[model samples]
Target: MQDSAAGAATMKALRRRRGLSLAGTARALTNVAAELRLPALPAVASVQRSVARWEAARPTRPDDRYQLLLGHLYARTPAGSIAIGPGSDFAELLTALHLLGEGERRTAELRTAVLRAATDQGAGMLSLLSPALQAQLAAALADPARTTDETVAGLAAAVADVNGQVGTLPMVRLQLLLAPAVDAARRLLAAPVPSAPLQESLREAAVAAYTVAARLAFETRDDEASRAAYTAATREAAQLGRPWRQAGVHMSHALTTMYATHDLAAARVLADRAVRAAQRGESILVRARAHALQAEMLARAGQARQVDTALRLAWYDMEANHAGDPAVTSFSAGHLRGFEGVCELHVGDPATAHDRFAHSAAALAAPRELVQRAIVTVDQALARIRMGAPQDAVELLHQSVDAAAATGGRVPALRLRDARQALRPWRQETWVMDLDDHLLDGLGA
Candidate 1:
């Protein structure tokens, strides 16, 4: 059963933030449970059944609060329609804000009902609108008078919904949703707000848009756009006094610089900045990641022992902070392990690198991000190459290159070039000769 109403609200807000479906939320809970190493786990099938029941709108047992929270969190929309008029009480704004703050956990039925009511002025019991009526409704929402704090917050949640859907929708549909929200956010922020809470809300909206824009830029391999977007997010986060968000932007910049351009010096500077911000904020995971990334940059620059020392220091720091889960921040134990593997490969410790790579690959198995997976493979191949198996390295390189192409990322391509170069001495060997020609051809070398 679920906890108190406040607990429900908390779960709902978090679920909405994650943008998961009921089934998806349930699955995530399972993953999080395993990640946290919790015992007394529910079977996947049982969770699925519970989700199905919730989706069907059947009344669930009260003790199932966690399940209900998961259901609500996974809900596609809010549960009720809320409207604020010209003469509406300001308290309504508080109510609307409260709902938005619920994060992401709402039952699907509740969300569906809410969206229907909010978007459709007269849903079911209200008027089933004609095309003209629907247009009128939209026009009414567009009316300048309707842009109250409550309405604006509702719109912000709508934007979050779109952004969340962006991961699953076709690009065109995602753009259709995101563009309007971005425009709306810009307009809202431009308007006068009476309070700090209002400003913070608008700032968060800007940050969210910037984050999405950065992701889109990276997806298209537009480094300039990526950097610009990160800058935008950083500015907003700074304004909101959100140090963790600032750290996130810096880390992202470091990643793009390091992997996209192979600019070790620049990467190191950005990573160092990120580390300092994370430390200042007492963000253990982010600091650990910054340390690990700094180590990676050093290794790439041929500082093996220094890389090892940095990793050791970061690992110890992580232990001291009792960094519970990488999921808590952009940095994770898994990410550190991957970074360690990459450094090991560079420092001529193939065996140790292989083990770390294996740990990274296994740890990141459930939520697959293509660019990250490619990095792991490239690291693994580097380890293999260092172990004197150019053939195996070439095969892993092939996989990495293919995956990177799908992401339009250049990092894996750069790694492939280095891997092939390592095999240059063995090019005359029958096992490596054809592979070399194929690799060069693949890279247009």
Candidate 2:
């Protein structure tokens, strides 16, 4: 729930980045204190209370020892900051707070950028580490206490919180955190099996983490890593024996085959597998997501009739309010409309696709939803070209290049280039030449 940097970074964000809950962080620090035989340690509750106050995420900053211990806890320095910004604005504001010497004021914040920006952009901002702060976070990761019911719950909650960030972050940076998260879950799972329910919870967390990792891999064009991660996720979910979780895994893998490899046959296999798993599961939301994925894949293959049937099934499942569904499903009216739009385009109905894309544009207009909007913008541009308006398509494509670049949407950025090539029939147009120059500039080509 918390966002923003304190003095360059917030302990809370760094703590969460390492897969610790507030209490887990406190306990980790306490454990570290015990191992070092440092003075009488604060009780976990007392430490947790302090951790909450420290999370004010203002420039008041934690003093030296606390900062060093946190660095040790997270296994890194530059532990002082997290993302929340209009770069220049946050930089200036953080500077002003430091200049005044001290104060605690909450600022509205967001981390979508941190997960989307280049890694150096995110962690490199906190470059003020001292020699004394160097320490291993591995100890805490190994602590038997980390697998307690409360801690396991924290792990689940942490991953769920992260998935909430999908569509906002860039594929590269999101994969960074997901790897650590999956590692933390693996640590818990490797511990001698706990109570059956806790074991199941750990498996689900591992499966969820692996699935998302695979998804990001798909986005980043790391086909081998994506494939390996999907395999791990499926193996774990099969052991968990939860149809819904396994279904989620299959649906995500479907995305990889559909986009990363563009292997229609492989995508079809995963989509069908997802639907079968969803059918055996209880969540309509999960089933809806599975079928929607099937519909989207079918759209890509230009299978009009099959796409229509799958879409109808997806919409039917979505009609109900399935409370407490996993955030990973990510289904919405707009998503379905976008799927239909893509289907219409593949089926050679540009005018209908344009309308559907318009609906998609509205749905993805939120400021943080830039990547989705950029993707839809490209589709809309393609539709425009198909409808005999290369100029309009060129204009839209220009804006999309910026959006896609800013959000680390390498895939969409590549698509923007391809969409520009679609204007070859109008190659003599001056605006098309202008668009070419702009694309070159954006690409540093």
Give the worst 10-residue stretch by lDDT in candidate 1.
Answer: 84-93
**Regions more than 4 Å wrong, model 2:** 1-140, 167-169, 327-329
Question: Each model's TM-score?
Answer: 0.59, 0.69
Which RMSD does model 1 reach against the true structure? 12.1
The sequence of per-residue lDDT tens digits that candidate 1 reaches over residues 1-445 is 3333443354344445557665676687676456435564488778756644433333232233443233322322233323222222212222332333332233322333333333333322111122333333344346533344554455455555544433233333344445555565566566655566766867776777677667656655677977887887777778866565567677778877776776778988888787777776656666677778778888888987788788987897767655454326355677778888888777757989988987886775422245566778888987887787778877777777666554444566677677777878887887666655555555454
Query: What does candidate 1 score on TM?
Result: 0.59
Question: lDDT tens digits, residues 1-445, model 2?
Answer: 2233543353444456568787887898787667546675678998877677666645335444554344334333234344232222233333433433433322112133222332544442111111211111233366644355555555555566455555565556566656667777777677764478878877887888788777777777788988998999999999976798888889878766766666889988999999999998877878987887788778777787998899899889888776876544466777777777877888749999999988988897555466777888899899999999889998889888777665566567767867877899888889988887887777553
Candidate 2: clashing pairs of residues: 8-81, 9-80, 9-81, 9-82, 116-170
Error of 2 at 193 (Å): 4.2
Clashes of 1: 26
Clashes of 2: 5
- The candidate maximizing lDDT is 2
